[model samples]
Target: MTKLKTDRREVPVDEPLDAEVVSFRAAFDQRSPIDQIVREGARRMLQSAIDAEVDDFIARHAHRTDEQGRRLVVRNGHLPEREILTGAGRIPVTQGRVRDNDPDHSRRVTFAPTLRDAGRYRT
Candidate 1:
């Protein structure tokens, strides 16, 4: 007796389900696997860069508290009233108590910058 060879057309290859493979292909085509990977990587890189910048800023301006447990960062001066201009309009500024100052009378009082100041101290 001779061994018989199976027809190539009757043999099944190692392939995924047609529906599953079609869905996968569609998803990849919609977003492109390469593009999705690149976008995720870029997003992570940008987030890391932003985190590093924030960390550096915080390290440079670490806050300290006084015996009274007040924020060491200057917030206001001894001035009674001051004029401040904002996007809306000009507004009156009320000064906060002086926390620390030079022994010498330099007449320059540093005020704590607020969100309004955009991170710039007022003098």
Candidate 2:
């Protein structure tokens, strides 16, 4: 026979509970079909808005061109996908990446979505 080691700790009333001991109420699998549908819709809408923002940025910089007469500020590709926590749930989104091909690094301009700057959506 082997001896068993059992350790116990005392908790204070003012102390907060550990994360492992707390249960989440908005678990993904536990959510209803309607909730899932709403989340999908929200994700699509958010993506569309971001795309529009990118388009607007490119339009505003249309005058900026290189020696070859090609637009300097244009969409290169998309950034890595990330999940943003929203009111509906965790929504996956990808932001458009803009490249400024200006030879002068000091005059280069970058694009940033307004939504990302807002504190409401925390990734």
Candidate 3:
């Protein structure tokens, strides 16, 4: 590789060169590896906990069926995708959905997971 020579009038030797000029972000962009690992761990843990909560909630009414042999609780699909901001970082998650089969068609229920103020899930 060849280095280009700069004109003396354009850039004085007393002043800093172009290569020496570093922006604040570029100079301080080094991230901590341990912090990244910890944040990833936290994200996975939160996701797992939410999944377990949904599973437990479904298990409560999954087995029983009505007189017509329709399961009491059935998995529909997923709710909506949303992200939650945490101390670690922003975590993305999609909660599971369930339909509660009732004898009366008008009284059927659908489970909607909500994030409580305590940083826990409420089904």
Candidate 4:
């Protein structure tokens, strides 16, 4: 699959819960079509949310930079794709990555610490 460029400005506000009957093409996977749609949508949602969070981090640190004048925190594209097991199913996702120009910072510069292996915890 190709890398998708999502516009961070396109985050939706509040939408009505859509439970209407929808059609989905059957595939080898046990997940129903709706499940697949949900999985993909969830993946995109998660990616977008993280992207926004990263943007906030970058903004907060924008005033700080290395000696070369490069931003302290910058968007580093994304990490490799990984599967996140959810109640819906195992959905493949590629999370956004950030480059920490300042190595002295205490934070690890990742969603990992905030997300903290979501699959292992039962929330």
Best by lDDT: 2
**Candidate 2: stretches off by over 4 Å:** 1-28, 119-123
lDDT of 4 by residue, 17-96 (tens): 34442223223336677877898898787667656766777787788777888877788897777676777676666656
Query: 1-123, model 1: which lDDT tens digit per residue?
Result: 999988765536675468977998787557566766765665455435434544444344445445676544443334454444433223344434444333445633343334325422233
Full-model lDDT for every candidate: 0.47, 0.85, 0.69, 0.66
Model 1: CA > 4 A from native = 1-29, 68-123
Q: Could you give me the TM-score of model 2 versus the true structure?
A: 0.72
| Worst ten in a row by lDDT for model 4 | 20-29
How far is each candidate from the true structure, as Cα RMSD in Å?
21.4, 10.0, 11.8, 17.5
> In candidate 2, what are the lDDT values of residues 7-36, reduced to their tens digit?
978789999877655655336348788988
Q: What's model 1's TM-score?
A: 0.32
lDDT of 2: 0.85
Candidates' TM-scores? Answer: 0.32, 0.72, 0.60, 0.56
Please list the residue runs of candidate 3 whose C-alpha ends up more than 4 Å from where it truly belongs after superposition. Answer: 1-22, 26-31, 68-70, 114-123
In model 3, how large is the Cα lDDT of residue 54?
Answer: 75
Q: Is candidate 3 or candidate 4 better by TM-score?
A: 3
**Total clashing pairs for each candidate:** 2, 0, 0, 0
